[model samples]
Target: MTQRHIIRRVRGVDTSDGAGVKLKRVIGQPALDTLDPFLLLDEFRSDEAGDYIEGFPEHPHRGFETVTYMLAGRMRHKDNHGNTGDLGPGSVQWMTAGRGILHSEMPRQEEGLMWGFQLWVNLPAADKMTAPRYQDIDPSAIPVVHPATGVTARVIAGELAGVEGAVRGVATAPVYLDLSLEPHAAFDVPLPEGHAGFAYVFDGASAQVAGQELARGDLGAFSRIGDTVSLRAGDAATRLLIVAARPLDEPVARYGPFVMNTPEQIHEAIADFRAGKF
Candidate 1:
């Protein structure tokens, strides 16, 4: 049982997206590109109203999944399919934009801290054009487990300690866990063989993996061959998001919100969107 170590470290970049909302782009940026099945990871945390009031206007997405996890504030979302929902604190929405979909996400509050994360996951070529779907999970629906004495884990996708997450039956089998570790606490979990894993530290002083330190806003990518990944909190408490998924290993052609297998498909997607097709 070899332990996985951080093979690379990438710091988040401060950027603006979705109607001028400021966010930290952890993936899909210059420093670090896509992570196989995972395309982008954005962390939006701001107390100012001007930063997030505009929110994300109506937009179209094709051939991927968008996961919105809220830690604070509220967000209202509606899609062209007549689906509407609210994401309060601790809520999670897993939206699969298989073929195409038009949606908008706006801040429900006028002011206060708005903290959340938006993760873009890539769909395989076979399922890229499937029908769009969503899994809106409430806070109470997510399972919280104590894997260690000073550790708490919120299982969002995949399984932990024999407990399945709220999300299931996806093209890419993914594991998404929000971990909180007290001082000196350690967490160890076994990852599937050949799966890509990443850990993003959001809170606390720092975390250590394989004797290397991952500071706040730093993302650590694990070695693919290791079967297990271990994390140890520093002097203070730490909070992080750990995600793993099987890679598609296919070619990726992306244009803004559209993602496909080739340039011709990308051109087709652009034409479809321009012609009032989702």
Candidate 2:
């Protein structure tokens, strides 16, 4: 019999990023700490314009990658590398801040709900100073798979049921999927051995691999022992995002927007940013 994964921890969303934005931080917290190559996961959702209108101002980042997936609303991104794009609903933006980069993400709409997720993935020591790059994906480019009668999965960065996702070549070997299930539907997904994985419920209710229940805005982090994940929808329709990645197993030294392997590197990054070297 195959081993079934269990939830090792659960977390609720919290306020972060800047003023006017409410986010639920799943990783990078004291309870969960760092998930190896995966550093942070934040879900930003709000109906009030004031809650997100201010937007993320020009900021600097180094030694990591940022993955932004929009569920609703639109976000316009402008970076110092002459990269510009708009992330509409269901779109994905994967940006690699290998060495360093300055960018801003602002809401394009004046009102209505603005909901999305931003995940921070750490880079290994060897690639920390590599060139910056990006993958801006349209909603249509993402492949949707119907694994079962009432199950729909939007593959973003991994293969599922013989269908490979569009966002590939990530060093972390990540699996990012947006799943929707109708009432009483069950689905089983395979995970690579030794990978760290978690699920975030954004709509309705869900029963996780270990029979643990998760409602909207809740995050279920899985144990590393299992190779398969199971999920079941509640009486109502449900939607969730599942992420998994290979562990880097390296030391983490984080300083605000920068993440490095050593304290000296963190200090160097700070000094370089102040001197406009990034």
CA lDDT of every candidate: 0.93, 0.86
Q: Pick the candidate with the highest TM-score.
A: 1
Candidate 2 lDDT, 234-258, residue by residue in tens = 7888998889988898989999999
Off by over 4 Å in 2: none
**Candidate 1: regions farther than 4 A off:** none
- Please report the TM-score between candidate 2 and the true structure: 0.96
- Give every collision pair in model 2: 13-24, 14-24, 20-51
Clashing pairs in 1: none
lDDT by residue (tens digit), candidate 1, 169-219: 988899999999999999787788789989999988799865689999999
lDDT, candidate 2, residue 149? Answer: 78
